[model samples]
Target: MLMKPLIIGQLKARLPIIQGGMGVGISRCNLAGAVALEGGIGVISTAQIGYDEEEFSRNPIEANLRAIKKHLQRAKEIAKGGIVGVNIMVATKQYAEYVKAAVEAKADVIISGAGLPINLPELVKGSVSKIAPIVSSLKATSIILKMWDRKYNTTADFLVIEGPLAGGHLGFHEDELVDIDMDAYQEEIKKIISLKKEYEEKYNQEIPVIVAGGIFDKEDVKRALLNGADGIQVGTRFVTTKECDASDAYKQAYINCKKEDIRIIKSPVGMPGRAIWNPFLEKLTKGRSEIKHCFGCLEHCNPKEVPYCITKALTNAVEGKLEEGLIFCGDNADRLKEITTVKQVMEELTV
Candidate 1:
């Protein structure tokens, strides 16, 4: 069957693919713009977006807010008219400001995850940019929809169901990650679709449901489409692309990774995250080094008590300090063979 265009608000993406947002400089303006140019919805991750700016370590929120417009402008220049969106984590210290920055930058859409974005509608009020909340289950989707409807009299432009196989900060607990079966998620997807239909009927609008996590090739996209998904969000595959903002060493890590290398590690932000097993991770597992001061980014984070500072580790990795940095990747990172351009990768997956 032929794939159809993905509609999010008034924007129509030629390919039903939303490039999953990676943070700490992975999916920056260059990568996102390339994906949009390739006919997909290119997403720029807003996690510590100003890490490259001077003094970001001292004031992350203010730095990131300033960087949002700069990145979006660069992405728009590269896209030349294609759809470009921003993926902001709800757990960030300045979530509201970042969302507003994206809106001000004329971002086509805003995809939020890592927590329930209950006030996302309110944050983007009066903006043309559509809002999408990423969820791990039907219950989360239901709760978000109901809250948005009741509080703001608004509905989501789209929904993203991110499964356990996704990289970075997971919504599920460490134990639940291993225990929950993929088959069970199917029912959850069905329930979310049903809930979406209810809201669509009430609001007289269509809410597109996109499935994410562990999606690799065309076969994976096909499975999602067959299972009631209007599109798919892919992350790890995009990491190996030429346009990705991550260092060459980081992409090489994905290319060289083995199946056993991908494992869940305890993040300093009090959440379980998936990453490639590297020398740094091995050292972390052995508890060899003492963690330095925390950056105080996440609300639940306790730097003095947690394992290590996630922002520092991730920023280090993105800066090419592979030996002492945390390298986040999806379970399918092991399957990647070589580096390719974003245009080539999208063509392979969509065609």
Candidate 2:
């Protein structure tokens, strides 16, 4: 077995693996805490963190901020001594507030994506939490590194390269996502590595780069390492785990899904998202359903102009309302065969 501890500056994990953050209440305290307890870094997604709170639909900010501490405290209790991190999307409506809450909750690491986290260092200042940005290309990495360096006099503690094949909202446009060659992405990876090396030379710091999106099994892990990734982030595989916070129906959907059933759908949040084709999606595509509410979660979303409310759809899924909820999954979700525990899944991936 290839077991190399991933060193993200001062933070270290027994396994060079990160449990990719799943949102809309999917990977919560239980899932993240279990992964950390099992030796890998467990990441809680900040996307709709206040998902189950009673006032989430009314006061998303207060609810989400409160949920951050709740989730972090629960994760810490389960972690015992392991690492726990949180993923907050930059495109979120309350990005700064959520990031500050994560820091205040004493999270070990904070991963931001969906846009360049130019102000991450500022949000995390005076805190011990490490900051990382998920980028899909070197251009994005360069832009972030320059901004962080110039503005905050800080370098990234770590970096994540999210490829087009990964689930949920993608960094690339829909057409580019399907049309780009994987071979071309390899160059982007190399450029990011080179950029990391440049910073290493200038600042005399070592920054670890992790790759995510569409990663499955040990074979995928090996491929990522070979491609210069310090570690790997796996998400969809964990959805079917016993410790996963998602509903049983959600897990079963992955197991029962075929490759063709996984398709890209327009998020009311103004981004293209990958999800399992379900009754909810069918209704949205056919314009048979009307969005009853909007949470103003994403900055670009307008309930009046969009097809449906993303917050409502995701919340429904989280609460087990399968027929009316949108279920997000990665490209490899169709390969899931059975549900397992978090420990079992970690062992399989680490091996």
Candidate 3:
């Protein structure tokens, strides 16, 4: 299959790839900027992004908003005019404000998921930043497209189809994912690609479909393209890259993990997430761990009630306190044996 540049609105990527957005200081200015500079789309995850700011502990909202601009500006500077985007989870507390912040900061693209982004179009109206909704099935694609059309007379600039094998918060339940059928999911992807045609024709524009989850190598990219996807969003493979913002130990965790070490766990935000089996997770199996402080990152999180404090756990892992922090990863993380650069990964996928 021949690689084609992914065009979303006026933005263009030399390769039809996007460095997956990892939160809790994982994919930030360094990784994102490198990906864009290397000719692919770079995405900064805005989840608990303010963790590094001094005001994060006192006023998370303001800190997170400030981090959005701070990171976006720095990422853009490193990008050197290349396309840079932000992944804004709808599950975040100030979802609308984050969307506005990304647009205000002049983000080239805004890909949102972790919940249905029903009001995304409204929040980004009159901005040049392209919007994409991360969906898992045709039903989700239909709902988002229909809702966007009915409510705002617009459609997604692109669509990211995340499958069951994805990391972090997944769209599918744990039960359904245990015996997921890739062939059946590919059929759903075909249908979604077909579904987008209607909206594309109506708006007289193209709506690219990007498949995520389990996409790791050139063959994976080839297969996705042959199956009708315009591009692929990669997370775990990028985690081990030198430019990734996570701590060295965090990247090493990907290299040291075994295939059996990966499994799904219930996130405190009420979603199933995939992560490595570590000391903290093993301890959780015995009983729930109490959260000392709540960052109030997710919209539905309660300080008193939840399996674990997501912000603290993710922050711990990103900072290299692996035993205490929850490290979210894709199923194929075990395949990584060494660290690489973003340029190498992009060339391997597109060459």
TM-scores, in order shown?
0.97, 0.97, 0.99
Across 158-233, the per-residue lDDT of candidate 3 in tens digits comes to 9999999999989997888899899998999999999999999999999999999999888888899989889999
- The regions of model 1 sitting more than 4 angstroms off are 288-293
Please give the CA lDDT of all the candidate structures: 0.89, 0.88, 0.92
> Which regions in candidate 3 have their CA more than 4 angstroms from the true location?
none
Output the TM-score of candidate 2.
0.97
As a whole number from 0 to 100, the lDDT of residue 328 in candidate 3 is 96
> What TM-score would you give candidate 3 relative to the actual structure?
0.99
lDDT (Cα, tens digit) per residue for candidate 2, span 1-351? 655898987888999889989889998999999999998899999889887889987888789999998999899899999999999999899799999999999999999998889998999999989989999988899999999889988899999898988888888888876675888887889889988998878788889989988788888888888888888898998999998998898888889999999998777666788999998898776674576766768977767778777788888887778899899999899999998998888888885
Candidate 1: C-alpha RMSD to true structure equals 1.3
lDDT of 1 by residue, 52-134 (tens): 89978787788888888999999989998999999998888877888999999999999999899999998888988999999
Candidate 2 local Cα displacement, residue 117, angstroms:
0.9
**In candidate 1, which residue pairs get closer than 3 Å at backbone N, Cα or C atoms, i.e. clash?**
none
